[model samples]
Target chain A: MSQRPYNFAAGPAVLPEDVLRQVAAEMLDWHGSGMSVMEMSHRGKEFISIADTAQRDLRELLRVPDNFRTLFMQGGGLGENAFVPLNLSRGGKVDVVLTGSWSRKSAGEARRYADVHVAADAADSGRIPEHWDLRPDAAYVHVCTNETIDGLEFHELPVVPNDVPLVIDCSSHVLSRPIDWSRVGLAFAGAQKNLGPAGLTLVFVRDDLLGHALDICPAAFNYETVAKADSMFNTPPTFAIYVAGLVFQWLKRFEYQGLKGLAAIEQRNIDKAKLLYGAIDASSLYVNRVHPSCRSRMNVPFFLKDERLNDGFLAEAKAAGLLQLKGHKSVGGMRASIYNAMSMEGVQALVAFLKDFEARHG
Target chain B: MSQRPYNFAAGPAVLPEDVLRQVAAEMLDWHGSGMSVMEMSHRGKEFISIADTAQRDLRELLRVPDNFRTLFMQGGGLGENAFVPLNLSRGGKVDVVLTGSWSRKSAGEARRYADVHVAADAADSGRIPEHWDLRPDAAYVHVCTNETIDGLEFHELPVVPNDVPLVIDCSSHVLSRPIDWSRVGLAFAGAQKNLGPAGLTLVFVRDDLLGHALDICPAAFNYETVAKADSMFNTPPTFAIYVAGLVFQWLKRFEYQGLKGLAAIEQRNIDKAKLLYGAIDASSLYVNRVHPSCRSRMNVPFFLKDERLNDGFLAEAKAAGLLQLKGHKSVGGMRASIYNAMSMEGVQALVAFLKDFEARHG
Candidate 1:
């Protein structure tokens, strides 16, 4: 209840306080059952309820049609990069749109399983690519909807060949906005960012794409087997799934400006991004290099005009109770990841810190 | 803690009170960082120390050999059943020794990738198979050391073909005893039981068995790729790994009677099993069906003599704060999973409840 620091960690980022409190209260005993949620059997009736409702809520939230199956899996986004190619690619040509670090990594890992081709690369712009070369007969086209490191995002998905499926790694920005399911054949994200915690990966895949896995696909990692078993083909990450179920419930009740559910959260995210990006654009001392049109709403990476004050800026930010504002080591600067849980108030406080820091050191 | 419930839910079962207390205390901020451990990046120096120390302590406790690489992965036990075949089986013949439910499941899942052979099965004796019929040319031999559902176990591993490696799913009883590294090619366990939580799988594989994954293996599940990147090839289940690390630290400092570390824990486990099994044997109202030699030291499944009284028994058990005593649906009865976190007092409490319930029923 005391003043807590505002966190801006990119991937394993800040979670909603309500979710944390709920977890704490349920740690000793869940729902008067005299056992923690962690202790329940995945197959038991109690846990079955948890799993059933989580899947149902997620389906409703995503407005997923009857043809798509959602699976709660393990391994993070990086794991899915190869997992995606292994299941969808048959050692055939696969087109990859390299938006930033994550998409590039995905293409590199996929090379072991498929003939990978980078249809687009935005390395020069340090942003999401605006143009993509279409490969009509490719197995699938891959994209990272939001890249945590480069601060690039594909607001509008690219049009790919009709024969090719589209795979999106939406790890950093999942649940923050509406996804265009028509443009995506398979989408996967780690749960650490906007969902409950680490360890759980949510995979949304079309029915037709399920059985195309290469002969060597691990049954557990195969989208077909997993979808058939409802993600219970394996002993699931039970506790993480249970927590995520609770989060879906929380999202169902979330409200903002007369809009409820995911829509409300999406609006809040948009507003938060606008406030922070507006401040950065207004300041001569701070600059975000990515094109304004394709900037990530979830992650905003920027640098001070003078790089010498980077250490000082971080130290002062920490002292002011603004935590984990440092950007990735690969890309030096500051990153403010305003996830679903990050309040407008948190962003406001961050903007104030940025201004104060600039006044002191500019 | 005022006589809390005796929790015996298998895996994600019971956690040490000390660990729970420490987690609660650190929920707001870890050390002076003003950020939850969950909020820290896996790449951060703070979390690197946590991940490194956990791996180090676990190695020291288990005395893992230099030739083996320990990787912290995601996906629960069942997921690994497929992941194992994907990484090590290479679609060749896989020999399986089915002691109980878990091994049977493993063999069934492996059939999707390999020409699976039942090397041994113990359904007749309600125990672990005594003699394993290993294939000299088998790609790998799989075993589940502890069967949580059936209360069966293979306390001592078998001598297998030298050319064929042994892969053990030690999910229910890992770290309870010293592992014979010379015989084990790969040992994997889900963290929910003796480790920490669900969603994390600990895989200790010999370096030599690293790179022969099937072309269909999901890149993330490939042991060679995971090892090359030190398990950070993707964003790992960071929070679970951190908690598992804390458990390793606790085990290192543990002492019992003149014994220390794993030796001490094993002795305690043996004593707890003896005490409870003895009570069950002496009582007319309750009975354990497992063969005496293979009865698990961790999970003990027993049935009430009067089948009609099962519901009454469970209701009373919950009322008495002996919780989650219901057996798995596959096998109808009661199961007591006294994992490493369960104390001697907890076992005594459960035993006392059993006696009281029997006396009333009689």
Candidate 2:
């Protein structure tokens, strides 16, 4: 909108402009307190109010059940890969259904704390597998609801064996739609994507999963201690949490015709995904490899039939004011992550760019 | 400052007004890049530039030698309590000097991973101990350069015996002065204090200490992996890093006529500490229990002789716009943390308030 490129980074991605403006206005003095939020102690009244409101608003927004405890954690999604096992695995065998890159990494990290077994792999399906062979008594089953790198996502959470709990790494596609909590025991996401900032991690765990950490688990990272202290066990990331609270407030006010909040965003996301994927599918030069059934609505990783044009395509795209459109290092191509903050105009501009690039290079 | 109270929270504490303003101005789009720093990927060119510049600027500001690797870590001071032992202690006997609350807690956490031995205790000395019984062959000797809650600090780093790495948890006083690297192998601090934000932790470890991590340490947290990858082994707290970079630039431009950079800050801190501590020592009604030799230049904790007036004192202080003056939950009193961002005017105001309160209640 300001004659700059639309960013499509997966995580550590965009935030709403409204939130940014509010943050700017309140930077020097928050509510006439003459102290920035960063200067307040986590235990201080100002920061305490911020933390409490963040948790309460998040709970209301997600419709998180009464039995679930929402925790503000650190150490990104990868850091939690080991922390999740350290707390829940108890050195017991656990099941992981590898949908994409994130799930694979989660299982690998869990191997250090638990006897990990892969229950399913979508590698054969070229998408997130619909089938899951979960162990009945496994300590927990891990899954990545949305894979940022692989552009694959599980449309619906798998029905785990009643004896096992489901822990999800929903970092990329969280808050885009409503989650069915019936099949999940724990849901976690790094806040860089849809929420607000990069440092804060949102962890929603059922209350019963609290106390079973391995002795080796650090006290600061132990779920039981964090939950007991209301996530202030140690100094939580106060500023990041404050920013995330602002994003939640923004979400509460989001509207679209007859829809509002999550419903409104869900409708927009569905429309955006359809438009881009449709454009990609219709083009002879552009191709997306993931199966249609599990194509991610958040991240769309596509490739050109001719790989050599990748450089030129990216260069021209950048010049045309579409930024950060390159794919991940491991997988070479292009990825466009149209998060909640990205508008319909941004996507339309992108679509227009895609058509123009195809016309020139085809 | 704008009729608001002074905030003396040890951490999750105050940041610079200029930096906060810059953050506000660029919150929506960083330098016309059309993306919030939060929206950029860790590996993208835009974010890579940010990461590189921040690291370079910090290294220059601290005069960090090339032999040391600066890692941007998570888990705060407490999380690093676990991470340090897991990465550097490596089941070897680790000698810890109990300076105050932070060192004691670090020792307790290290016990899970290694043979933790307390080499000295200042709980009796009423100060952080100067001499330590550090083991000659210990993996590392740990100290807290500044204890936030106890208002105690080591004015100079202890010179441990040969090959015994000295690890200082400088969480409360990092960048407030020039680090004595000759006697130190590793120095770590949470960024919330004098650095920038709550989620970022800066760890400076000598290169030689990189490879000896415990086998059970999480790969994402392993110092060797992080150091080798330039702290990009995982998705970092991108926004926090950018803000910290801005702070580093601000520090570069800081001047105190004869002093510049950290030297300017150190002098400012010395002056601030003298003002508040002098006021406390001058009044019979107010007392600071810590030994004068090792009083923290950052945190000044003072108690009213009449404990009955504590509540009323806090209430009146709040009315006077002195916020977060409450001490740690473990120690009930008042503490004022004057980081680099807390101006001398703020400290003078607090001193003025203390005098008026003592006079009214004496």
Candidate 3:
């Protein structure tokens, strides 16, 4: 067997090896259904069961509130930038916490249908803003719980007026920790990061948030329509959903340090983040610019103190079987996205490499 | 090995077994990259190469001209309904040829963004209408080349004004035949049907049609935006693209009935359609409502002369390893969607079962 390289892609990111192997085993025929999950019609009974099981497993893994209806959607985080405003804004005022690039793009896209008001901006700091001007009558407040590019994460969700739904894009850090459903009215995450694949976006919308979409909202994307149809309104990314279901099941069985599932995964994520950040802080050759108070647990962005080592570091990392560590183009530094699928051993290997490289370069 | 059942699902339909096997084989590690294709970043070299090769192969298979930019999009055919007008209509009059269920939905959805003029309606005949009320000032003319539910197909594309771009929703029959690039402006198909899976959409838009998206268009779905970004405006459904690239490779090497590649697939489709249609035509127990002149080659909706036998027919078909032969709820009859992946032998099996069932029940 070939050695499995540790993948650090932001997303479509690494999936659990066990989940991938299980998916491969069931690829030709899903549970003796005589059809691959990909081949079954969205409306067919076989696919319906697969979807139902997936939705159920996902709900269990996330401990999604009973009031929150999980809709399997498309268009990713970027598409949802436009989709969120179109569906929830109702051509009204939308308050945005411009934490980083993701929220900034969300606010920019929201301007198409609504009057976008940046309640606070943290572009320079690459952290969640300390201040926010809340508009109670505003349609919703958009936030990025974890900024994939800026490597900033909100340790705690911001408090907004009860009237305004908190639409959080947790694309990068979803599933790494349990979301506080009590504070969030709608939380959407593209599955690529922590869930499953690129094509499927998971929207956990509070039941009350449905049906407020403006007339222009595409019916297929309308939260009300999608929730009512159970996300089968249009063919709901069947294969992605199937793979995600496997990941969810794998998550349910996940255990580490005597903890289980979400708790277990969250603990592991914390450890991985600490170990990597500890290395960076201990090193004279590397630095992470984000405020440690809101540093992302899933995405660790670090730079060589000597900028000239960037290419050499990347090349050597690739040679050492660490892949996709190149940071987003918006940020020139390196970013290692250690999602749930990324095991602790992988991060340890990366840390070892980082130390070895620093020893030689420093 | 368990018998490979014949799946006739409308979309999210059957895939080539060989492609499925190849995908399964590479499920754990893609070409020793030590990561599944689903885990690779869309912008990464590995996934980018996969997307590019898929685009190139599809272009070659369809004989798509140089001027057309092949975009991998999301939101499916329904999403494209809104995406189309939002991008191409510019809030102007958009002419539509309403052939059946699919086109009706298209025209209705377009009315939100444009003054949709139903240039042609074939609801009564279940075939292409003769006269078209094409307006020269219209942004583009919309048509569903194959109406999946209505079992109607346009034998010939209408000769609209040179100023009007002909946008086709060829979701169900895209790769089944050669497209006349001279007559098309933009063609979009959700990959669920003839291609690999759901959640991925193939958009072939001419270069001249770029940059006219309305302010309301989501940058992710905007033709100009997506075209410029090589469909990486969002993650662009990485897994779906990899599977589709495999399908394209399968199509490139396909040989049967003294033909090769697209020619071979088209010939097989022609033969399959004829065999099934002939069986229905000659049968006393079954009836195909579609007009013979424009019956769909990909989806054939047939009814039992005795409607009471519908349940029995579906049950027997399922028992005989013919799955998902049930018609769409909108059309209360059996629909046999013999897509590109449906072999000639599969159609023959269906025909054989049809005759045997008729002898038993009729």
Candidate 4:
């Protein structure tokens, strides 16, 4: 393995080194097209083939139902906060379950286009709320499957009535495991985390939810328009999509333990999260406050019990080739987001560093 | 120079070879930071520095005034069609000067948010209209300075009254020449063409125009929100901005015929456009329909008199390492987009091929 630092940025986070190598190797010319993927017109057959393969591979990996239309789009998760309501809300009531900062933002943005009701509020609980007061008349129910900042995730989705489709902002934990698409009306993810690079947003919308965008929704963001054009409605972030396609290929070929592909990645993620959280729990100098039942398998936010050592811990971690361990300013201390790209070895290194630091500081 | 094919894609177009090489070399480790540019956190000092330097270099290159806040955003030109009105229109009357397809789309999208009036229609005219029906009470006057598909351009912007801000969609020709900022209020470009890549949209909005978004505007696309947050209100496309920053640096270091930077690029663009148009005008087999005075200096669309040879022309050109010469589907012919990245030699090669093909078939 390469000796590069293990980057722990929450999103726009680590990508597999092998994916980066492949991207570098192919930067000058993608395949034999004699043009960089960035240079290819989005409408060209070469790019179309790339787009199709990526969609197909992703569908196969997730076992997405045939009724869902995968739309490659721009405008990260924040953009979709409004887009979901604009497309699905029909200018009616939207029931939002406020799990953390992300879902709070979603409800806030959705209020501009629809009547928003917080079906459940768990922003401070550090765990998923056990029950939601969903309304049958609601246009949709909005949830954030993984809160990148709070380090909380939904291990199982909240049950909504069949008539009221569920919408998820799964930016951080997408592709780490399989999604339960049967209950999902739409799932949107910003590709900066586990998927690939920044700038691309993936939206999987069931066919039934296609054409009801509010007049205020931009055509580029109108789900039906994007679906019809196969996300070429507005250039669709060509380079980002190409890099993401490469990532899907990487995920497809991934093998670990006794499993393969998404199954393998899920197992690895579970192992890495367990190792890091276990170390934090056992250490005197470190702490993680989230409920174990819902603690994120991707983002593991921890703090130094002695808050004064925060800077020293980050400095020491950087010196040891661990990068971006500082926590989000909103919820402070330190965050080590071990996305699908983070290896067990990388996690082990972090655990070792944690123990050594605790021994010295304690 | 590398022996790569001359790419003639319109937007998501050709990028400087040196920039691509730098991107490739720095893919695994960015400036010894031990992380790919893609992996760096947007808030991290490493990426913030990259973003800052890029903004500074772009400001310097364009000589952007202090009153204008340059924002790095997403959702391409099509997205900006709605964003322009949503942010600037204030749900009032919007007067649009329809130059071609892009401006027409802009007008159509603006109508969704504002009471739109076609102040000038030049969609069928091969040149810019000499006059427009000015609406003094309008929120803004919209114009597409260069129509990428129609091969039409405004050598000078229409004289909108001082009170009304003029919004220009300059996606195709931005960065190829200096903007006369004094004649404009806001200038927006999808960075797929002369800038760097797709997914990153550049908006230069005057400070006075900041806080006037419609109530329904998504916060992610709200100009005031974006400006106040310095385009970090949401995760601005980090990788695209990094690449564009490199392109900006490349432009700063550019030299041609004793000219430097933007001046050098402008001169080269002028020369490249001249070479390609000159070739078509001199040929009996191909003809350019747009008026010479208002012809685009970026996209030069031409038609084969004997249309049967279109297939042969494209095939032979591709065989000779000239790529994406086929015109846009909306306008069926051939187009050579000689943006800032296209070298004089590339144009010269295309001209030579043009003559050789005509000599045998004329």
Best by DockQ: 4
lDDT of 3 by residue, B128-244 (tens): 888888898999999999999988987777667766899999999999999998998999999999999899999999999999998888888889988888888878898999999
Judged by DockQ cut-offs, the docking class of candidate 4 is high
Positional deviation of B317 in candidate 1, in angstroms? 2.7
* Cα-lDDT of candidate 4: 0.92
Q: Note the DockQ of each predicted structure.
A: 0.54, 0.75, 0.87, 0.90
lDDT of 1 by residue, B1-362 (tens): 64567788876688776676676667657887766777777877788888999999999999999999999988778778888998888778999988788899899889988999998888758877657787788999998988989888777877685768999999999988889998899999999898887889999999999999886666777899899989887788887887788888788878888898889999999999999999999999999999898899999999998999999998888788787888888998889999988889889988998898888885
Question: Going through the candidates in order, what is chain B's TM-score?
Answer: 0.97, 0.97, 0.98, 0.99
Query: What is the lDDT of every predicted structure here?
Result: 0.85, 0.87, 0.90, 0.92
Candidate 1: stretches off by over 4 Å:
A90-93, A127-131, A137-139, A159-164, A211-215, A257-259, B90-93, B111-115, B137-139, B161-164, B211-215, B253-260, B304-306, B356-362
A1-362 per-residue lDDT for model 4 (tens digits): 77998888898999998899999999999999988898889889988998999999999999999999999998899999989998999999999999888999999999998999999888687888888888899989999999999999999986798579999999999999999987899999999999888999999999999999988889999999999988888898888888899899999999998799999999999999999999999988889989999999999999898899998899999999999999999989999999999989999999999999888986
DockQ, 0 to 1 scale, candidate 3: 0.87
True contacts kept of 1: 0.58
**Per the 3 Å backbone cut-off, how many clashing residue pairs does candidate 3 have?**
0
Tens-digit lDDT track of model 4 for B1-362: 77999999997899999999999999999999999999999999999999999999999999999999999999989999999999898889999888889999998999998999998887677888888897889998999999999999888876688579989999999998999998899999999998887999999999999898988899999998998898999998999999999999999999999999999999998888888898899889999999999999999999999999999999999998899999999889999999999999899999999999998887
Ranking by TM-score: 4, 3, 2, 1
Estimated TM-score for each candidate: 0.92, 0.97, 0.98, 0.99
What's the candidate order when arranged by decreasing lDDT?
A: 4, 3, 2, 1
Q: Which tens-of-lDDT digit does each residue in A1-362 have in candidate 1?
A: 44778888886888777776677777666787666676776767777888999999988887988888899887778678877887888779889888788888898889988998988888768766567887789989988899988998878876675757888899888888888888889899999888877889999999998888876565667889888888887778887787788778888899999999999999999999999999999998899998888889999999989999999999999888888889888889999999998988899999998888888888
Worst 10 residues of 1 chain A by lDDT: A32-41
